[model samples]
Target: MRLLLLISRLDCLDELDALICNAFRRRGWEVIFGEINAIAADDYRCFTRGLLLPGSGEPCHPGPAALGNRETYFLDECQLVWVMSPPQDYAARDIWQMLWLASKRTAFVNSIEGMMFLDTKHALGYVLPKENRVFAYTSNDFSFLWERYRQASDQWWVAKPANAGCGQNVFLLPPNGPNVRTTLQCLTGNAVVQSLLYNGEVGAFKPEYTILQKFILEVANGEKRVVVVCGEAVAWYGREGNPDDHRSNIAQGGTPKSVELHSGEVKLAESIGLKLMEHGINFVGIDMAYPYIVELNIGYPNGLYNEMLTSGVDRSDRVAELIIASFENHCSLLR
Candidate 1:
């Protein structure tokens, strides 16, 4: 079967290709990398790339035409549209209409609506219940922060913008910093200062650039989990941080290692997968650090392809099988 993976082209995605594309090839199915651009669409009309994918309807093929603004467009050849990652423009624009359409048209690993939910670390406690989940301690305003810190001079707190992940614009306060309001404005439109989380070390708590969350000490498999409901564990890898640093996200210069999941971890991964399905998010890449779910890469998860090569396991083939199975299941119910 031919599948289309739409995403920005970047070197970080080497692992993804190794895991997915190589896997598909091994299964005797064709895998195609598709990047959709509106202007490029007009130039390549009615043209099919040399990728073979089969679905319930007919052999579906997709190309740049899948993206053009002919107002209404449909592809009979494309059985699935895998949005590995939306275009760079989409994030800056906040909302992407085509991505929404693709979700409706075909099986989206992680639907557009799903990205709207899990991309930000703010309001994480809301998505993650306080009962099973831990929240980064936070105060709504600067005055509350100053008063709280002064009461406990020995305590150190770190503040993060409402919505940021992957270590973006994180600030560490030195017990006291002037211009609380200005700091809030600069860091986040609305921000919070929260008590730092650590095992025993004391230097500065950046909270690893997401939420000021209550940290969990999970026994990780070295590689973080990226569970894809429509397929197998297509990829697994994470950055490794030394004592000086806590986060191991590859984007932060951590070394990559293959992750192996135990059966319980697999079940935990599946439960979260179903939760995402409840939110109309079927396919996702889960980041399980150690104890619980740390981050969810829903938009377009990269790195699996490369990891596949490293592990000699092709998750893409499994993903293709899962997609076919789901499609068949849907069609069967209709029949």
Candidate 2:
């Protein structure tokens, strides 16, 4: 079988992508790489520059359309296309829509429709009970934010972009904080702040709005990432934030360690994983802090390398097996 991994860029494949690509190749699957921005689509054909595996030393097969080290590929040729990049531009969105409409021919690991359902912070409302989930307010209006902030359960709130992940643009809002307005302004991009306060740095992705969630004190201990594949909890790890930082994302210098899920967490992860699988979202990483399900990572969930390093076992092998099995099962059902 053939698989196309849709990533943000070819030259910048991270550890997780490299691991997955190599794992699938070892399983006798022909693996090729495609960047979202380089894809050109039409009713007749879908074209892209198939990138060579980085650090492969030199190009072996130089096709007619080979530009430098890249090869030409047609989207219809691949049996499966695993999207690892979120659609962030017009070109990417166009490619996504084309592929989505042609999903019958090419199986998607997580369909764009599935990502739309549970990939963002907004998904918390659908997955979690009102009392169990974090109390969040999403809006671009300053008045709405002010009202929500005032009604928060605690004096502190976690302010972040609604669409971003990996702890990007996350901040702690102190009660009646001086930087409240400035932080909201920066996050929502509604009103420009003369100067950023409280270590507020501009993010890479521009967000349409922001989510102000009531801070959970229990997060001081740590957070958990439960990796679910094909509606089953396969592996999990714990992450603790760096000193003086509230963000527990490994991208933000947090530390990961091996851990087991509590009964409640196991039940929650299993139930949610099944529901997500039914919705065509097979691979996922569910983040949680005790009673609350923080985020659902359906687009590109990290931690495969970390799982191997911490547990001394390659879970990506299991991930690959499950993905192929699921894809074959889906194809069989269609047949």
Predicted model with the maximum TM-score:
2
- Candidate 2 ranges beyond 4 A from true positions: 51-69, 152-154, 192-207
Error of 1 at 327 (Å): 3.1
TM-score (all chains, Cα) for each model: 0.65, 0.86
Estimate, for each residue in 1-335, the C-alpha lDDT of model 1 and write its tens digit.
55555545422333453345444555555555543443122233222222332222222222222211222223224555555555565443422554564455565545666676666555345455444354455644445544554564443344565555554554544444565435544443233232323343444223332233333455223437465665345456554653454455556555666656777666666766666666656567777754466666676455555455458665656665676677668658867
Worst 10 residues of 2 by lDDT: 58-67
Model 1 quality (TM-score): 0.65
Q: How well is each residue in 1-335 modelled by candidate 2, as lDDT tens digits?
A: 78888777665676667777777877777777787667776565766777644323333221222223678877788888888777665665676766676565678888778876678888889866776689878987666786778775348898998888888999999888888877877777654342244234565224358899888987887888988888778888999788867788998989999887888888888888888877788888888888888888887787677777788887888889999999998889988
Which pairs in model 2 have colliding backbones?
Answer: none
**Candidate 1 regions with alpha-carbon error over 4 angstroms:** 10-14, 17-19, 25-32, 36-77, 89-95, 126-132, 137-165, 171-185, 189-210, 215-223, 231-238, 242-244, 258-264, 303-312
